[model samples]
Target: MRIPTLNHILPALAIFVSGAAFAGDLKIDVSVPADRQGLVMAAVFDKADGFPRGTPLRTATAKPVQGKATLQFTDLPKGDYAVTAFLDENSNTRLDANLFGIPTELYGFSRNARNMAGPPPFAEAAFRMEDNAQQQAFELK
Candidate 1:
């Protein structure tokens, strides 16, 4: 049998490699209160510089139902990531804060990280995304 040429083999190899590259999914479950209504927003960060602030590497939003909500980030590559979420009660698409910069709306982080003097650092919320689907839970406070 004649062997296939590079032109024929390269395309198939590329497709195989590309498919393997995106073999992970990050699923987040947010526990919202039944009385609260609005949107559940989340942010994913690959670095600590602007973690829990600024723009994130990825973002997701979902509406709560029966005191629960879920957000899924699919086709993610293996790497370190941190997540932060908030309950947008006003539907303004942004977390509200008081005059002292303290959040007035409910918020949460991956691993259930809590703020002491300030928001939890990336190290506290960061998680590794391997070659499998992973799930994380957060509770609004």
Candidate 2:
């Protein structure tokens, strides 16, 4: 029988330790208009490729009450992340946009970043997540 040497085991141990140390949780607080009634939809992205329109790494929904809604994404690896959210008042599972490509629904992004033409770029809204709980807040526009 052969026993593994220290060199062989060190690399494997480092990977395991690093990965385990980086798992974290993110809590999102969204403020909606008190008169609005619908689901607060959110999506989390790790990259800029799809951004506001692309498929997200994770998605969640929370019903608003008293002008506030909260959602949590747990066990995420340490990295850069951006969030986009909207108040789906009509419950169509999508943001309502007007003829000029302007959104009619209340919406927001991480860092509260906004652009005159469209959604803010990923870099503008990206945040670093570490091995601890983090909180982000947004208000519907």
lDDT of 1 by residue, 104-123 (tens): 99999999988788899999
Candidate 1's TM-score: 0.91
lDDT of each: 0.91, 0.92
What's the true lDDT of residue 18 in model 2?
79
* Model 2 alpha-carbon drift over 4 Å, by segment: 1-15, 18-21
Cα lDDT of model 2 by residue, 32-120, tens digit: 99998889999999999999899999999999889989999988888899999999988799999999988999999999989888899
- Name the best candidate (by lDDT): 2
Quality of model 2 by C-alpha lDDT:
0.92
Specify the poorest-scoring 10-residue window by lDDT in model 2.
15-24
